[model samples]
Target chain A: MNDPIEILLVEDNSSDAKLTIRALKEKNLCNNLVHLTDGVQALDFLFGRGTYADRQIENKPKIILLDLNMPKVGGLEVLKEIRSDHKTQFIPVVVMTSSREERDIIESYKLGVNSYIVKPVGFDNFFKAVSELGLYWLLLNQPPKL
Target chain B: METLSIEHSISPNFTKKDIEILKMYFELSKKYNPVISEALTADLADHPLWGPLMKQQTPEQRKAQNERSLAMQHAAIYEGKWEEYSKDLLAQGVMYAQMNISYSDWYELIKMYKDYLLPYIKKDFADSAEKAILYLEGLSKFIDFAMYGIAEAYFAEKNRLIQANEERFRAIFYNSMDHMTLIDRNARIILVNRIPSHYNKADVIGKSILGFQTAENVETVKKAVHSVFEQKESSVFDTAHLAGENKLYYSSSISPIYSENGEVNAAVIISRDLSLQKEAEEEVKELNRSLEIKVEERTKELRDVVKELESFSYSISHDLRSPLRAINGFTHILKDSYADGNEEALDAMDEIINNTQRMGHLIDDLLEFSRLGRAELKKVTVDMRVLVETVIQELTRVPSERKIDITLQQMEKVTGDQNLLKQVLVNIIDNALKYTSKKEHTLIEIGSYADGGNIICYVKDNGAGFDMAYYGKLFGVFQRLHSASEYEGTGVGLALVQKIITKHSGKVWAEGRVGMGATFYFSLPKPRK
Candidate 1:
């Protein structure tokens, strides 16, 4: 309970996942980084089900970095679920994806996403984008009290 | 008067003794009248006036009636009163006509009587030769006078029959429903049946049939009429006549009328109106033509939509995904090859990352461009000045090192989708900012002017302008004249701007010169009531 998750990264691609983790680590903002490969697992963790049943539901992540193009239970659907439930609705969710699709951006915001960031192609810009998002969401962004 | 005197002088000369002889001849004629009458019928059976009636009469009765009439004529002729005798002869002529007897039959009866009486008279006056000769001459003259009367009555009966036939034929010609006309050999209209409502009968009668037709049709009708007369053959043709505002189509049939000597003297033309039939045929043809055009237009629209869908799929599968793979592949290689980072390797990795970012922007722009096709326009009366100010604020938020001065002018309120029009302003303003970054003092102007019923809003910038020659490619997807090194763009900004404007039922255009400046303009419809 004392070691509540700081960041929950839901991404399908392994390489993108690694790059994002490295960017956060370089910025010294990688404390208790929870990485889920698919949206289904990410939902399981958020609701404390399946493998994360033992974890308390009240101990929520500070920020959820969700990816849009995923194999199971895409990011938009996950965001919708998070907003509908009273327990998880207040949690800060940042939609991070390779898709700069306006549909995803507009829809994510409509579903109560705190931030929306497109992952840059170059490693440098990619690192900068993730680092800045990590610092802002973890430190500067004020989340509503659960 | 002269004919009367000659007729009087020619009367039979008879003395007092001759009269007695004539009376004796009359008594004897009565006995032989039947023989005379039988001989007359037999001799003149082929006469037109009596030919039909003679077949109906018995020879015995005919001879008896003829003998009495002959006896009367002899008695009347010798009475020495010419007027009274002439009257009796006329009465006899009328009786012959009433009985349908022919003139030739009556004349034959008198000749038979003369033949029978001549020997009796000659025997009685044998010693007096002059007296016998004079009586015979006088008898011959009386027979001639009787023939004149009978001939007049025969002609009067024949004329009555001819007049009846003429009336019946005239009724049929004048009462016909069709436009019947009689034309002379010179093609002049001699008579018309019922004239059409459009013309006077008198006007049409003396005119040629060709006069009422168009110039082209006149030649055709002329040829038809000519053939009917020259070859004495019937001719038929179609003709269109314009009477007032109405056009009448007719099928004309012309046939020649021959004279007694077998020469073509005139022609009869009968025309029937075909306007209703022609109108229906033309209407059907027009309907078929329109149906064909509609089918062709629908097919063309379907083909265009299919082509657009194919290109959209290609952009999604190939154009967007290719760069993503490169970024992913290169990043993996960089981490593996250089666990400890080197300057050159890091730079190479940075270049890969930059290209990946450009590709991401390109995908975003392409998605927007495609979405415009599907988006339903939600129209509102948008204030152009407010929209321009908001877009300019968004563009300048990137924190550029150079100073930019943006001027806003009074803009007309226009009708458009609020969000879509905002996107158009954002793209154009951002372009103005980016191109003017090299200038010492960047200046951007936003304004609108009236052009017909539309508001032509324009954004002008003092920037690195494009060549006028390549202006055509300015609004095309990924078509940029400037190299990637010279300007940082995915070359989709202007294309996206054009799409948004076009979706709002607006038009976009630009004017620029190399190293000078560019002015981008878009026209939107004025707000409606």
Candidate 2:
């Protein structure tokens, strides 16, 4: 409880995921974090299934940093599972990805993602988007206690 | 000595001898028409019926004689002696020979009098000497009167028939519709009616016409003559003359005209000009070709107008969305940061933000859909099995505690625009998650199979399903089957899914019951090898 998981980042692009984590850490928001590179591994961590089966299931993060493009079960699938179950459905989830495709944004909100973020191609815009998303989801927003 | 012998054998009285000679003449002259030997008029020229009378009758007696001959033929006068009859008949024969009276003329005169006199003679003079004597005398006079007239008419008619035939032939030769020239076997123009009469006619008629023809035409004309005259084979040839008004395109064929003995007498050359008709037809063909070009130009102009209209719609959707998106983004920020202790206000503001976000999504979707319509598909064989799994992974990147049991049933890799297919899957799975949010547990499945060379994939969810009544609202831009309060949505997710799938030459649709779950299915063609 002292170091509550503030951000749970799931993405597959090493460069993009690293850049996002770095931007969030620069703002001192990445200390309480759990990062998964793919949807299957991310799913396992959330439900304590597969490799994360030994971990406690009751540990809920304050905000999840989601990337839309990833291998195996992706950001959208993770969002669906989060919103479907009574235990995890109330946790705040934000979609963050390099793709700005219209469907990606609409689907994120439809699945009850608290916010949708598009990773910018340019260095300055990428920094600003990551910093803003981390601040809004982790420090500013209040989380519902389960 | 011969005179004495002939005299001893003859009659002594000159009057009696003359009478005997006339009788012999009369006997022969009674047989008329020497061709058919039908007697019509009895004695002609030397008949005693006229000449002896002419020798006796004064100028004053001539009318009376003509009257009596007419009167006897009419049966009004009948006076004649047997000896006079005999003498008249014999005398007519000699006179007929002297006049050179042909049987044809004698035949005509006899036919004329047959209708007038023959019936009366047959009825009244059948058997008696007196009647016979009357018949002979009447016929002799008729023959004498008719002979000179008939002989002159015959000669005149014969000459006229010959002249008429010559004139008819001359007319055809001079005014023939086809251009004709008569040439001897020597290739000389013996006669040329249509050609200029003064055109060296004397030289051309006897000498070879090859000297007068154009240098090029001379060889052609000679070849034509050899073929048409010597070889006796007819041929047609086209000749081009680009000179002045006399210029003609002549198609001529010559045939040898033969004599009765089958010797080639002359070659008849026939030619006709078709230059004007051919020129008119060529002009019509040129006009039609130009008209076709004009039609094609007009069609291209219409296609350009259609393209302009399509781009106009795309721009409108894009420009209109930016401000609406700002309204949505700012409203959410206000609710989060500044609505302290005002629960109802926060709730109201959340609702407003939600609607604005929905509107923003609608605008973006409409623009994207329009863009896809024009975008050229970049086709590639994406490992779609791995691709869908990756999309599913991205969707689940949010909260860590929710349990999503994803059964990927025999997924197959497919060919498509990789990016578009990923977007399509993301939208569909995300939609299922939104509907199933209230469920105690959620079950989602991503599976694929093949149908008739197309790869079909399904995303199924055990969730709160929409009623069949509102199914029409599915996959339409900004048309939501579920309320925002129940499970939040921009209503454009399925529509965007469908568009992306369609852009990849695929199709998307869904099936569900009200309280059961929904399943989205899409199909795409395998890439051509």
Candidate 3:
């Protein structure tokens, strides 16, 4: 089977997504990645529907990078949606957001997010977080598979 | 007639001088013109007893002849001596007067006649005219004796006059209007002018006052008496005389009446009744007690109402948020899914979202204000100097060139809730920044002091001060001195700050002049926590 797509980044902001993908690639951690901007596109990519209908389900990412405060379904709803499905429930997802509210942190955890992080305010910190996250999840990640 | 019967029966008991004095009284009474003229007719008609003697003698001689001379001759023969004859007659006459008069008047009359007539009678009766005069004197003596009997009647009338006057005085003394009495230092009444029937006629005059009082009243009377004596003053007690079972009285006063030496000789007590005054006082006390109970009950009811209001606000706030959050969260979904890439439409929707967030803030502020009503005040010592610094840091908003330079003065430690005080600082500082948006520069300050036991902290800002007309709206919920368009706020920041400060047992107020910026002040206790 084709190598399962790696690093499925669910982000709505095109500039932030481009900057994130560039940062991950600069670290040589991007391979066979799939990016979807909204909950509809994200669901389709995961379930192999429409254009991705013929896509193999076993070729799935080891972990998902989720962005909250997005269009359509935000990160928390997306986290819940993934956790409820038997096929995707075992996949690890990390939530990142601009809000530092404690409520958001607890809810993300409650929805089975593997980790939660605040979106850094400055460009340098954002670049460093993407580099670190990419190297950990795409390279050295020890995710469970069945 | 009664005397004649007694005399006829007892003539031997009367002596010679008694008869002689009796004859003289008869002779003297007739000599008075009224008696002489009346007896002349009776004589002219000639009484049968004196007619033979009267024919043998001169008429004046017969009228005044020897009834007394015969009685003296008889007394002389009885005594057996002529020299002591008059003395023996006088002694015998005194004895006869005692037996005849029975009381003092007749004896006095006998003595009076003997003193004048005894010597003359004792002298010679041997002269011839004496024999004829003496024989006629017996007839005169009989008339004189009858006049002395009439004099005794007049004496009895004079004694009656003295007794009548004494009875009048006795009536006035026993029935005087005032409770007049003569009392000794021992409080014994020597004389009580009232209630004479209370005493035996003779006993009350010298008896103690106790005789008038029953056993129960004695102790009460004694208490008054002891006070008078101890104070060495005459006292008057107006008190109830509990002589009978149902008796009740109110005493007005006890006053000491003094003698010249200031020693208490007597106490005259006058007691009045008090049932009316006692009843009135009891009525007033009852009214006061009932009024207090009513006030207490009213206060409890009011407290319960306030608690209910707080609970209602709480539930309203909590329940309102659930739906509000759903609206906001779903709006996010719509904004993400349906915005048609039109920048203007997206921006308008963002504005709607921001307004909803502000509405949420307003609801939260309302909840806080009402919650303050139910929350108890908790006081703690707070150092405003460090507190203001921390607040400014949290509210700094990553300080840009638009930052405010708020100079802070050293503040004294004050007793208040620390978290609540921090909110007050944040609200005031943020308000300064919001108001000074149009200004080239912004400034604010914080400080405190010991104003009596209270520490007065103040925040001063150079900002767009509001009109004085809106002063009443300063601390009210959703009240903004300026319009929302002029200043972007939910108009709830100051209200929340005020609520927080109030819950800490502190007071907050503001002062401002148009165009001159504003100063907010609060006073909290500086007592040890």
* Candidate of highest lDDT: 1
Worst 10 residues of 1 chain B by lDDT: B1-10
Span of 10 residues, lowest total lDDT, candidate 3 chain B: B1-10
Clashes of 1: 6
Candidate 2 local distance difference test against the native: 0.66
True contacts kept of 3: 0.00
lDDT of 3 by residue, B150-256 (tens): 33343443344446557876786555444555566676666556653434657666677665565566777677678766775444454454433544445533445
Candidate 1 vs 2: which has more DockQ? 1
- Give all candidate RMSDs, comma-separated: 21.9, 23.1, 25.1
The interface RMSD values of the models, given in order, are 5.0, 10.3, 11.6
- The best candidate in terms of DockQ: 1
Stretches off by above 4 angstroms in model 2 are A1-146, B1-307, B325-348, B380-382, B412-415, B496-508, B527-529
TM-score for the second chain in candidate 1? 0.43
RMSD in angstroms between candidate 1 and the native structure over all alpha carbons = 21.9
Error of 1 at A10 (Å): 3.4
What are the runs in model 1 whose C-alpha is more than 4 Å off? A1-8, A27-34, A39-65, A73-95, A99-146, B1-347, B393-410, B436-446, B461-463
Model 3 chain A weakest 10-residue run by lDDT: A118-127
Model 2 residue B517 lDDT score: 93
Q: Pick the candidate with the highest TM-score.
A: 1
Docking band of candidate 1? incorrect
| TM-score for candidate 3 | 0.38
TM-score of chain A of 1: 0.94
